[model samples]
Target: MTLTDRLVRWRYRLVPDHVLGELLSKRWMDNAIPLIILVAVAAVFGSLIPGFYGPQSLSDLARQWGEFALIVLALTIVMAAGGIDLSVGSTFALGNIVALALIGVAGLPVWAVVVLTMACGAAVGLVNGLLVGYLRLRAFLTTLVTLIIVRAVVDMLLLRYAVAIAASFPDSDLWFWFGDGFVAGIPVSVVVAVAVALILHLVLSRTRPGWQVLAVGGSRRSAHNVGIPVRRVICMTYVVSGTLAAGAGVLFASRLGAAGSDIGLGLEIAALTAAVLGGNSLGGGRSSAAKAVIGSLIVMILVNGLVRLGVTSGANSLLLGLVLLIAVAIDVRWLKNRNKVLAKVYVSPTYADLPPAPGTDDGSPYALNDRLRPVEAIGLGEIDGPEDVILDEDDNIYVGNRTGDIVRFLAPDYSRHEVFAHVGGRPLGMALARDGALLVCIGGMGLYRIGQDRTVERLTDETNRSLFSIIDDSRLRLADDLDIAPDGRVFFSEATVRYEMHEWPVDCLESRGNGRIICYDPNSRTTRTVLRNLVFPNGICMTHDGQSFLFAETWACRVSRYWFDGPRKGQVEPIIPDLPGYPDNINRASDGTYWLALVGMRTPAFDLALRMPGFRRRMARRVAPDEWMFPNINTGCVLRFDETGRVIETFWDRKGDNHPMITSMREHKGHLYIGGISNNRIGRLKLEGADPGWTGWQSYWGRA
Candidate 1:
């Protein structure tokens, strides 16, 4: 390989994947980058320009910052709610004109004038809201039209009465103080702007209205389905936008002692630029008001510095336009390739090469066999990716589907099926509680309970996060498979904390210890980590004697035993090592043994890739997701193991015609029901010698 390849390989060996993944996945990283840029810009200008950091320049900046900053805050709220108000500049100018007219000609009190001016602005906002929210008009187009109409009306009013208003109100100390007064060295307008920004920040981050706004922005259909008043939320955002813009206008007019037609010109572009620079998404949902303020400060500083340098207004506009374009391009590209970028930065673990697989000869345990009888396909096209299968006391088969549903197949012929529960997340492993309640591990959501009445309740979704972790580790990301202990404790395995459920292949490539085994006590309603730092822990099963449990670590291709009562209690020991294929779920066999399902067999190419950590990391970043080397899950086998962990017998669909990628198998009433992660329907095999009445429930809980 080239020198660059060699250097990357050496670097990969020096760092761990989990550590790198944790650093890249931090939430603060988004805001931190822009904050750093702001600081750098400020420092460069402060050192290069004379009087840039002086008190006089700072005070003037504070006073001027309020006008545009308020407008920026207005745009931020609307943007967060998945809408934009292009009419803000026009509303600001109109507010100025109305304030002048009411005070100069109408001879109204300052307080009454302020209220009337604000009311007019609110009226314009109400119209915009009605069009966008209730009338279903496009926000951008509707607001653009409003901008034209409001500007036109403001121009007409100015043409008719501007000279009279200007002559009537030549001096008003009270009004000027609203813009020029200072408290604790901060201008009154600056204080108002800061307070408003703070309040908006709190509302968006902590209040119900803010959540409703974000929810609507995130997905309007979803918000409506969840019973949120989508229209009302959208309407309220525009109202806030117009009111804030109007307040900015009053401040601007007061500071200048005149209401000019061009006073609010180009203010919209500045506000939008500031919001975008602060990391506010144009597509909406994920933004903060605090970011807008910081963005506004950056814009103000840049403009002030440019003016000090005697840059032409045209050049200033060009520079601002370039900044906006570059910032947006960077933000969009980073968001699109965030996962790939993260993969490039991290070092995945490398594994020892896989040994040669045993031939499928007559003497081999995995020899070609047709002992697994084919059954009619049930829910053939209806179910998707039944990763794990279970049965209720009445022999009703329950399968977890890829579309976040738990489907139940009726007994006898297993023809009739219906959706049992909609978990809203990919459901993986499932178990039957002693009380007949169903416990399910929803991939991204966490552990949940489904009662017979069809009520779904979340059991637990958090564990004690590692103190050293920068990201919040409390939330489970990929809860894979679960099994219950006799003493009312529920045990489950989180496949990979570093990646989500859909990114299982990426986790395999990483081959790092990002998985953990957790136990939840129903009596105490507590969940705690029992074992940690496992490599893609997949399936879990409690031992028959209630003394230990078997957990399959997929990437490691090994099964481990954790004892609860024996001398090895609190310690883990390998039960089976160096498996030919990656194991998935473990189920109790009827004859006092266990059945282990191998999801995929390791291939030579994947084995070599595992040994080269740097190669895998590069592949993850450069290769398309579908083209990435994944575990060979197209062919698998189920092996029966004795209590001593010795292989008893193996059953395989050698050609993978009837069933492939067998992830889980459970014996009930002499029929072995098999499930696969990518199969449309489950497979059933008849075991002639096995007890026809034996069930997995009896194997665990015994006959009542």
Candidate 2:
């Protein structure tokens, strides 16, 4: 390793928390150049100057600059987004003064003071947000003017009225703990500063708002294109920063027991220095709250150390100014400003390098799985609620089209097609008999059997007795999927016992979870519920042993397995939680494997579903009868799993971008016959390396 890299390595192993360990590295450049340089200067100064780096000296240094570092963190956020908040120093001073006045003069409780101080801070921040976001002004100049006005107001408050009241009320116990208090071990100021850093860091890195902040900073135009709320996010940043600043002010007054003119003195310079030193440039992207704190620590440590070393305060200021100037100049050393701005605008979210969210059967990892080869689209128009695919003895693909058509697509090349059955009223789930006759879940028309002569025969239209809650208007018009047991009995799921297909999300939001997994006995001509209150149960697949079946409860984003024959008979357990997408239909493949069709992805919309349950039920009751409420049907995908529920490979279609919606897929012989609930043409993806080991009847008949 290079000399500088070795230093960074050693520092990271030792004093890593101080500078985030970049000071010891050689390759350290870009945004963090200022911080690295400051650390190097600290090292050089401490080594050359006597008494520097001593424990007591460093502690004092850190304590004095604590407020400055806090201001820097607040300022860094504003500047990083190509905006400025010069009112920060004034706000800082006002916060400290207001907090002291509340506790000492107002004769109120400590909690009340904290709340009022925070509200005051938020009001200041909101004004800033309102001015720049709504009024539209140059951030630097706008904040500069605000700084003057706010400072004048602070001067009037202290020299005005609140200060006199506080001085006269020194005997009051209101300022007892707040003016000088400690809970467990640490100082309250230190705790507040650290808390602010930790929370904002998480909000920016892990939550949706953080993404929006970066997007707005990166490029307002680009942010809008990707659906980031450019104005609201930007405005919210001001609020967060302002609120945090207010909190810090409360701590300052509590610790000091006094508010003075010097409360926010020179805080802007130090905060700006810490931010630039720690990284995050005005180029509008790339800032970390953690690094900003580290930068703040470095400054605090240096000043305290110098003072403990018996260096004069004047000498320390001179040294810090020289070092910070050199540190900031390095930010401009690499690129002209314009290129830097453009780079931030074009970059995607930072964590794009991480793996996709769990259960994302997007086929990205299985792109080399041969079956996922990019091919021409034979053009499938919008198909409807297709729940299953069955290949008859003729090798012809039969798909249960939700629009009441048993659609057929030819083999080898998907060049020919015909209606194999037209059993109206939303034909959804489908199953092929041993003799190749099709059993279908004709929504609202009961399950139907498709005869060889292309005629539809009604099976059981309704259950023997509907549950009291599911009478007449049970909304079984949205039956989802089915699987046949070894005894020829079919088990199916009615996706909702209340709302129709369009309101599935509404059902989840309502937490009714009223769906049921029902059994259809062909001999008795009866349908009965085996499991009820299943929470939007959608997909069903019988196990190889016929003891139980696995079903997908879509709204819960989980898979459920019910084993009826084993020692664990009649019990349900989670097979998997948080499937990458919303599960729709599942069928057993020939090789003891299972294939699942994802109707749509579980995205941000689903998150909103959990919080707005009442809104969902109301919407469910109002939406039109035929409106399909899912996402991006233009693209759909499928997942494969072993008997143990381990994911094997993924097959996906990118819609017009690649192919089209493939809601249901099946492996027949060596080919994957694809069908969509709404696609006009059936997809035929040749499994180039696959063996013809999974034909439905052959496996069931022991003829494979």
Candidate 3:
């Protein structure tokens, strides 16, 4: 190999380009930009302004930020429920005046006054909710009208009670402490804000009401069709928003000990700015309390810094407006293009150097022929993508359909097929247990079994997780095939950990070792990884000795043996290093041999592309998925090999008529039954001079 080629291969392997894709796939990545801005803003202000990070400065900032966070969180909730509340600023002023009037003028207890203040806010919100939700008015216009009405009420109330609230002071220590007191060196208002944020976070993320609110926001018609009580959820969101706004106003009243016209003027703009800047989607359906808190900090720091720098009020407003516009633009554009970005970066291709494929020319041992063309097709056009075929003791043919069903065709006639079991996942490899249960490896689900009475049960869906691995490999992604050992242990192949069953083509593009062999032991009710880092490990078959098993790595185009019980336990030895096509499933033959299915044939051009990882990477990025060159899977053949991996014979469907993509085959009662994942039928070929009474069930577990 050239030095340049070697360096390129090493660079792709060692640098872990796939890590960036994995990180981007995470949901938390949406918060990345806002976090960066917060850090940058804090650093800049800290460096430019004197005593910006000092304890006294922070303490005062905390008091203001905490109160503002509550208001922002209130706005976030309303926005998440697919509604907007323009009345929040007026609601805050009304709450502040009510709290002061109830405490100082009415001589009410501090606790009662707090509750009354929140009630006043709830009353205002109820008016907005009734108009926007039940009356089916536009949220934007309805809330705007409510804003004017609430502002007028607050002005009149202030005019009447402003003098009394300023003259008479409340003697309650708790009321004063609510504003100035500290808990463990943290301001009380800050502590309350944090507590409320946690509760709101849980409510939105973990509770059913929160899910309904988000659902309503995402699409009201869809949410209503799903019976989510859309209008009620929208109504509740406004109520919660008003309550939270009023709660923030209580803190404002306690701290300042006064009520005025400018108490909450233009507060709604600041709250909205923080909500969108912190990564909450303004178009609704996506938001969180933590985002509200982060946004609140950014706006509070910026405005406070500008104010201390002696910036004019008009300039401060203008700057905030610009920031809001930028934030909204980012939110809208990011939401629109996030999935497209993820699709481009998530499929990272890696360098793969496959061995030279063996020749399939005429007269060669792997010669192509039309032998499978003459085979009899069973359940033609009725069965759908039967990936594997098996037979019971009575010659009853069983096949897995793509629609998550195991179909059983009766013996002798093979005319009528019945749904033997509905396992609800795409069943791939199946085996008959000693007690008449059929064990199956479902594609997305893990191991499962169907009893004789047709009751389905899940065996294991997870295995021991790999420590220090970025991806969670414990959960089964694609349990492709399986074979049972003598000791009740079922060994299976998970095709790829990074992709699902539908994304198998994409996994082939990566050509990385993302597959693993897992063993599920019924005795311990435990599943564990026996071997890992194989390239698309597709099929598994236990050897006759019960000490080791053979498995096929499809993308690697090789068969390997691994010891599980003997002295060489956990040791791996390659059996077949090179093949002309991609291998799918390995099954035992009746004549002390094994049958291997090559699901697709290899092409010279594709083989060359595999060695050039950069070329494949460009292809994936520069073209549509359907336009990408994939492995030639539409035409393949089946072959038989001995224990030493010597090719005894081969069968081909060169005309592509009967069974083209042969994924699996089984020897039963003198016939080789073939199945393909892309074919609509199962093919049965009569074998010459083969054992007429051999069955896979009998070979594994002795005949009853």
Candidate 4:
């Protein structure tokens, strides 16, 4: 192992997983760390230098920082929107020159000069915007060219009228006061810069346009696909940059009382440096205007402290460049490996090791024998990954496929299959409502209803998220299975909040309590959490007595019953615990028993990994996804349990030739329909001596 790897491993071993996980999971930590570093640097400097924090020194720092602060703000806007404005330095100088020319050459009023100068700045921005946005020119190259052209133009203008403008505008008192005047003990420029920062911060964070800018910056192609007017948003950012740059220029002229050619010579680099230091990414789509101000403060402090410490200007430049390089390197690395890093620190809950499974021929109730008689392969190659199978009143079979479609086979022969509805998500457990609408629990989405006409409507996608989540948790992440109660209330199990539906194995690895059971009431049109902090709650089944429902926590290898009626109402109790496999879907059978589909038989290696949380966390990080040791989903069996949770029967495909990884099974009309998440075909088995006329719909609605 590399030295760095060994050190990181050692550090992790020494620290508790929860402490590291919580600290690393916080979103604000990235921004807060830089601010903290800045404070620490300031403390070191303050202790070394006298009067560093005094009012006079502070006032001087604020006064000098105002114009540069405005320039930094401009850079931040353009950078956040995935573009850069290298012409800002030239634009600032041009604005001041325009103001000076309007006042001195045309003899215009101060207000007219200010208005014309700003217009000139906007005109420059318009050119840049058109070139970069409409003409599809590269931002960096186009702005670089504009920077040179504007600077040359400003230089020529200054050369010709240098003597005349300065001589004519000698006694411009209002202009001088605008740059240097104080309002309530603060410089006017400082006040203006601060006000602009606050306003822009609000706009960027709280407004749609600001979000559009970020969206475009994150990915221009994605923004275009989503119809976000990518070009317009990009163009607007340049215009704002130009406008702010002009304001900074006016302040620059006022503060210095001269429109010097070198006034904005290195302002662009300074602004870019400050923005980068403040946590703005060069690649775009991430920034905070408030953090830009903090970055600017850091830059100013660094420069001022170097000067006070008798450091040369050359050394100061070198130090700033070095800091920028280091910060960018760290930021890029963090961005690339954030997920891996998080996985390493994730604190998974410890689980007890499962016992060895009984032999297939042992004759135990949970034994894996050849009880599942495969009769036919329905939709063999046409449908893929039919995780759940169901039946309607006519014995028309329905199965939700992986391609976000609910496929239905006609009754009698079950030969003709067609798409019943396109739910646009991975549909799992489904139930029929009293009004004939098909209620489905869509993975990654929420509960949805398919009308008799096959029109899909979203029922509910949100519940009270845990307050401890780092990201917004209102939206459902993995709504896995659902079952409807007698009173028309729909209960669903959200598999895991930490991982998406496809990343179910990650939940198994984490073994954390990130799952919950939620209920949606049709009359109230609302969804609320009924149980919280479960470990991969997968399948759900309502009881025949209509008093309680059973839910399977896959990672925990247990089934829990939540009673809402009778003496046990408002209580939750474990009905089935410590199973030999990870259960997927549970459904009511025709013979007053529940059929549980064991998705995967647990192995000793995986169970041992579950008990060792530290090993799982490290494995999640160090191992590639394909190489990760997931639950043994390649082989599975079906188990029948009574109301008291006693194992009554077992069914297995020992060789997995016809059906494997059985996730769900439904019993109807003397036939047992079975489906798997990884299998290409649905299996049918003849149930000998079973009720030939019994249907799943009649079992629920009683021949309605």
- lDDT by residue (1-704, candidate 2, tens digit) is 45754553354345313122222221233434455656776887788777665665544444455556667778767765657677787888888888777777776777788889888888888888888876777777777787788788888887865555457444544455543444474444555567777876887688877767776777878888998767776676677667767777876776666766666766666666667667666666667676678678667666655765789967976877885786567556543553544323211111001112373434443332224445444436535545567776667767766566777877645467777767767777777776566878765666677777777787665664454442343335667677778788888888765556655544544444467887878888777777876767877887788788899887566777997567988899877665666676777665678888766655665444343433443444455424524333455667778766677877765434444556567777776766666666556666656667557666655562
Candidate of highest TM-score? 3
Q: After superposition, how far is residue 203 of candidate 3 from its true place, in Å?
A: 3.4
Best model number under lDDT? 3
Q: What ranges in model 2 sit over 4 Å off?
A: 1-66, 161-180, 306-329, 332-408, 411-413, 417-704
List runs of model 3 lying over 4 Å from the truth: 183-185, 370-374, 460-475, 521-530, 564-566
| Candidate order (lDDT) | 3, 1, 4, 2
**TM-score per candidate:** 0.77, 0.48, 0.93, 0.83
Per-residue alpha-carbon lDDT of candidate 3 for residues 2-114, written as tens digits (9 for 90 to 100):
89879988998898888878877766676888888899999998998999989999999999998999899999999998788888888898889999999999999998999
Global fold similarity of model 4 (TM-score): 0.83
Error of 1 at 384 (Å): 6.1
Better of 2 and 3 by lDDT: 3
Output the worst ten-in-a-row residue range by lDDT, candidate 4.
Answer: 347-356
- Each model's C-alpha lDDT? 0.84, 0.65, 0.90, 0.83
RMSD vs true structure, all candidates: 5.6, 18.5, 2.6, 5.3
